[model samples]
Target chain A: MTSAPVYLVDDDEAVRSAFSLLLGTYGISIETFGDPAAFLARAPKLKPGVLVLDLRMPAITGLQLHERLAAIGCDWPTIICTGHGDVHACRRAFKAGVVDFLTKPIDEQVLVEALQQACAALDMRAERAEAAHLVAQLTEREREVLDMVGRGWSTREIAESLHLSPRTVDTHRANIAQKLGTTSVAEFARLALIGKAP
Target chain B: MIAAPSFEPASPRMPRRLAFLRSSAALAGGWLLLVAAFGLYAAETHRRALEQEVSESGRALQRAISQRVAQHDAHLTSLSALGLAQAQPSADFDLVARSILRFYPRIVAIDLVRLGPGGGVVSSARAAGGTTADPAAVSAAVKNLAAGRAVYGADARPGHYRLMKRMNDTMAVSLDIDGRGLVEEDELPGWARLDLSSAEGPLLEIGARQAVPPFAARTVEFAAPIASETQPLRLSLHRTVTLSQLVPPLPLALFAALSLAALVLVRSLLAHRREAALARAAAEAASRREALRQHETKLAHALRVNSMGEMASGIAHELTQPLTALLSQSQAGRRIAATGGLAGSPVDEVLAANVLQAKRAADILVRLRAYVGKSAGEAGMHDLRTSVSDIAALSRIDLGRRGIALDLDLPEAPVAARVDPVEIEQVIHNLIRNAADAVEETGRGDGRVVVTLTRAAEGAVITVGDNGAGIPPDILPRLFEPFFSGKPEGMGLGLSLCESIVERFDGGISAENGPSGGALFTVRLPAAGAIDEAKEAVQ
Candidate 1:
C-alpha cells in the first residue's frame, strides 16, 4: 500500500524554511519546492498526494500550479499558503484542487493541524487500496452464489437462474460467507457491497 | 489671462498716455500755427514792398526827366544861338558839342536832324557814348509818339540802368538824351549794395521774360519832339532802393517767424525725447517688478517644499504601518492554511477581512501624489475658511509634536475673496510655521497663536495672533520692506513682496501689538470685490 506524496511550495525562503519546519512536527514528510515550477516538474508522479502550495510567487502562482497539477491527474489534497492577501488567487487555488487555504504569519498549531489532515487522508487511501486488493480474491462458484445471495435473491430465484435447488444455493452462500471470513451472511453481504451498498 | 486695464487709477501711479497726448496736441497745434503765420507774414511784407517800389519809381522817374530836360534846354538854347550866328557851320560846332558835354554826368548824347530845301536835310547824331537801344522797345515808343503822346519804358537790362522814351509830331531839332549803358553802377545811388541784396535771395521778382531786373528806388524818363513835330528825343533818371530801405520791419518779421518755427520744432523734439526717456524708465521699472515677483514665487515654493519635507518621515510611517499589518496578516493566514478546510471556520472570515484591509493600505499611497504634483498660480474666488482649515490640517501633527496650541476664530459663513489658493495657503502656512518657531524659541508651555477672521468696512480682515516677544521697535516701520527680515533665518522678501501683492489688490496690511500681549498682523482688502463683505446684508 502507498500513501500519497504531499507537495509543499513557497516563495519566501525564511517563511518556507520555518513553515516547513512547523509542518514537519506533524510527522508528515512534505516534498517541498521553493517555487511552482519545481513543484510542477515533479507533478507527473501522480501517486495520489496532497499539494501544499503558496498562492503568490514571481512566476507561476499557486492557483496556476493547482491547475497544472489538476491537468496531470495529480488532484489529491491541495492547501494554499499566502503571505499577503487571502485574495481571489487563494480562493481560486482551492477551487482548482486545494483542500484549504492559509495566510502567512501563521500559527504553528494550525500548520500542524492542516498537515495532519493531509497525511491522514494519505493513510486512508493506502488502507482503502489494501482492502480493495484483498476483496479481489474468491472462487468462481462461491462468487456466483454469493452474488445471488448478496442481491437479496430468494431461494426459488436462485434455483431458476442457476438451475439449482434453493437449499443448495443457500448452502453455497453460507460457504461463501465462511470463506470470506464473516460469520453472518448479512456481514458477508455488507462486505461484498451487496444490496446496492446498503 | 488678457483683461481690460482697470479704470480705477492707483493713487501714486500716474498715467503716461494722458500726459503724452496732452503734450502732443499742444506741440502739433503750435507748430501748424507758427509755420502758417510765418509764411503769410512773409508774403504780406513782400506785397507791400513791391507796391511801394512801383509808386516811388513812377514819381522819381517823372522828376528826374523834368530836371534833366530843363538843364539840357538851357545849354542847347545858348549853343543854338551861337551856331546860327556864326558863318561856318563846322567852325563853332565843336563849342556846341562841348557845351552839351559840359553836363555829361547826366547826359549821354547830343543829336540834331534839320529840314532844309529838299523835304528834309541830313540828320546827324552825337553822344557821349553809343546811342543804340532795343529796336522793338524804341519802335513801340516811337509809334506811341506818332499819335502825339509822350512815352517812356523801364530799363531792359539787369544790373544796369537804362530807359527808352519817344516823342512824336515835332519839327526837326537838336536834342540831348541818356544812352542805355551810359549810367554807370558807381553813379547809381546803390549798385554794390544791390548785389548783396540779391545774395540774400531775390527781393523783386518778375515771372515773365526770365530777366534779372535792375534795382530801382526811383526812375524818370521823358520823350518829346525837339522843337518840332517829326523828330524825337528822350531824358531819363533812375535810383535803386534796397530791401532794408523799402520796409524797415522786414528783419523783425522774418526773425520773429523763423524763431517761432524753430521754437515749435525744438519743443516737439524735446518733448518726444523726454517721453522716450520716461518710457524707458517705466519699462525698466516694470522689468524689475516682474523679476522680483518671480523671485518671491520661487522663495515661497522652496519654503513649501521644505515644510513638506518635514512631513516626509511621518508620511513614510503612515504608509509602512498598514503594509506591515497586511504582510503580517497574510503570513498568519498562510500558516493557518496548513489545516484542512475549517468546519464552520472563523478563519475564513478573518481571511476575507484581511484582504479588504490590504486595499485600504494602498489608498494612502494614492493621496501622496497630489503633493508631488506641480504648483502653479491658479487664482480664483476661494473660501478663506476652507483654505485655512486645509493649512491647519497640514500642520496639525507638527503642532502636536511641538506641543503648540492653535486658536481658530473663523466666521460661520463662507469668507470668500479672490486669491491664489495655493499661494495664499503657502503664505498662511509659512506665517504659522514662523509663529511656531517663535513659540519654540521661547520654550514656553503658554505659547499660543490665535488666527481670527472678521469682516470690516475695508473688507475681510485676517489676523495671525502670536504671544511671543514682539518685533523690535526699530524694525516695525520697515518690517514689510524688501530684504529686511527680523529673523536671522529670514531672507526678508516674504513679507515685503506679500505686501506688494496685497497693495496691488488695493488692500492694506499692518502689524501691531495685540491687546492680549502678542504681535498681530491684520490684512484689509477693499470691500469692492469681496464676497465676504457682500454678506453684510444679513448683519
Candidate 2:
C-alpha cells in the first residue's frame, strides 16, 4: 500500500504548524495551505489524502471549501477542527461529508484515531474497487448464484428461488467463486453488497 | 455572554402636557382668588362710606329743624311777659299779641283770657291772621292754668300746636302755632323726611312720610323744650334717610369703582405674565434636557471606545483562531523540545508560526478598536444575547477583582434589536459596574449579580439583579435622575445615560428592589425584527 500525505487547509498558521508537527511524529506526511483558494489552485494534482479543515476562516469557510473541492473531483476524507461549533456548524459539517467533527484544542489520541479511521476507509475503497473489477467478469447465471449465496441461501434454496436445478446452481456458484477469486461466502457477500450499494 | 438590552427613548409629550395643564389651572385659580378677595374689600368699603355719609346728613337735618322750633319758643316767652302786664282784653294787650304774631309767622295765634270761678275763660284778647286754638282746648288749658301750671297741646294736623301759660294769679294766655313755618319742605334731601310733634299728639311733617327700604336707613331725632316756666311744651323733630342720596357724589363713587376695575386688570395681567414666564422656563428646561441627552450619547460612545481600548488583550480572545493556534503551536514546540528537539527547519518553523499568530491577534485588536471608535453610526440589528455577553466579558475582570460573580440567564431564542452596538454595550457595562459596586458596598457573605434576558410581546426585557444592598427607598424614584447620586464619588450619570440610550431606542428602564432583598434593574426595548414582521403583515 502506498502512503498518502494528510492535507491541512487553515487560515491559522500556528494550527497548521502544530498539527503538522504532531502528525509528523506519527509518521504521516503532511501538506499545509494557508487559504482554501491556494489549495484549490493546486487541487488537480492532489492524490488521495485525509484533510484537516478549520470550520471558520476568512474568504472561504471549511464547508464551502469542501464543496469546491468536490466540484473539482477532489473529495478527500475531511476532518473539521475549530474553537467552537454551534448546531448550524455541526449540521453543515456533516452535510459537507466531514469524516470527523473535532473541537480544538484537539486531543492527540483522538486526532490519531480519526486519521487512522480515514486511512482505513481509503484502504477499504481500494479493496472494494478491486473486488468490483473481479466480480464484473461473472456471467449472468453465475452472478445470480453469487447473489443468493451472498444472502446466505443454501445451493438447493438458491436453485428453488431461481427455478433452476440444484446441480446447475452449484455450478453457477463455483464459477462465480472462480471469477471473484473468493470462495468464502463472507467475501462474496461483501462484494455483492458493494455492487448493490447506491 | 453579555445580553443585548432594548433601548427605547422616552416620549416627553405626555408629561409636558400634564405639566402645562396643572400650571395653567393653578394660574387661573390664583387669578380668580385675587379677583374675589378684591371684590369683597371694595364692596365692604363702599357700604361703610355710604352709611357714614347718610348718618351725618340725617343728624344735620334734624338739628336744623330743632333749632328753628326753639327760636319760636323764645318769641312765645316774650308774649307771655306782655300778657302778665295787661289785666284784661285791651288794645295794648292785643297790640302786643299782634306785634309778636307779625314777628314770628310760626306763632299762628295768641290770646289772653281771664279765668272764671269754674275755670272757664270769662274774657280773652286774640291776634288776627293766625291759627285759632279750639275753645274746648282753651278751656282745658284754663283748667290747667287754674291749677297754677302751663300746658301744651297738639291738633291732628301735622305741625299744629297750642300752648297755655299763666300770665298772673287770675289770668291766662293761649297761643296756637304752626310748626311747618320753622322749615321749608324743599330744604330736605330727596331721601329724607322730617316730622315735628309735641308730647300731646302728632304735629307736622316737612315732607311726605317715607317707607323704609329693605336695607338699612339712617335716622335722627331731636327734642327741645318750647317754653321755660310758663308752659312745658316740647318741640320734637325726626329725620329718616337712605344711603344712596347721601353717598359721596357720582365722581367719587365712580373713582372707587374704576380703581377696583383697574386693580383687577393689573392683577390679571400680572398673573398672565407669571404664567408665561413659567411656561418659558419649562420650555428652556426641556431644551436643556435635549442638549444634555445628545451630549450623554456622545460621551457614552467615547466611554465604550475607551473601555475597549483598556480591554485590548481580553478582547483578543474573540479571535479564537490565532490564540488557539498559538497555544497549540507552543504546546507542540514544548513537546518536541522535550524529545531532544527537532533539527533546524522544524524548530524554526514553530517559532515563526507563533510570531505570526501573535501578530494576527494584534491585527484583530486594531480592527476591533476601529469598530468601537465610531460614534452615532447608523443603527444595525444585532443579536441581544451576544451583545450582552460581549459586555459581560468586558466587565468580568473588574467584577472578579471585587469578588462579584456575574451569572447570565439568556433565553434560547434570539432576541433581535436595532441600536448602535457600542452605545448599547456602554449602557450594559455601566449597569454591570453599578451592580458590582452595590455588591461591594453591601459586603455580604456572597456577591452575585444575575443578568436575565427575556422576550415579551412588547419587546425584549433585561433584568440585572444583585445580591447586595438594595436601592434606598428615597433614592429609588430618582435613580435615573441626572446628577442625583448616593455615592460620595459617583457622577450619577451611568443610569441616566442608560435611560437616555434605552429611551432613544423606543424602550423603557426601571429600578426596583427584588423580593429577596436586592436591587433589580429592568430594561425593556422594542424588538427589531418584530417591526419588520408587523410591516410584512400589514403589507
- What ranges in model 1 sit over 4 Å off? A1-198, B1-231, B235-237, B246-254, B257-265, B268-288, B291-299, B302-314, B317-322, B325-539
> Given candidate 1, what's the lDDT at residue B498?
52
Which CAPRI tier for candidate 1?
Answer: incorrect
User: Model 1, B445: alpha-carbon shift in Å?
Assistant: 56
DockQ of candidate 1? Answer: 0.02
The TM-score of predicted model 1 comes to 0.26
Residue-wise C-alpha lDDT for candidate 1, range B1-539, written one tens digit per residue:
11212223233333464343336576566656665575566656765665555445434543543455445545555544554544234546665665556646445444332322232212333554424344444454445443222233333333222232222232223443443223344333322121101222322221122222455333222222223212122322223344344434556567666766776666666667667777777677676556546645665675556335324323432343335345445545644563665523677566656655655554444344234323325457777776676566555446868988777777788777676666566666666776777777778898887677777765778778788876667777667644567888876656644553454344556777777666777776555465344334223
True contacts kept of 2: 0.23
> What is candidate 2's DockQ?
0.09
Residue B236 lDDT in candidate 2: 44
Per-residue error (Å), model 1, residue A167: 48
Lowest lDDT sum, 10 consecutive residues, model 2 chain A, at: A83-92
Per-residue lDDT of model 1, residues A1-198, tens digit only? 224555667655555555455445444555667767766877785456777776545435577777787788776667776543323344345445566786544445566577668767766655555534434565666667667666788768988999988788778866766566665657656555622212
Model 1 residue B492 CA deviation (Å) reads 27
Question: How much lDDT does each candidate structure score?
Answer: 0.53, 0.67
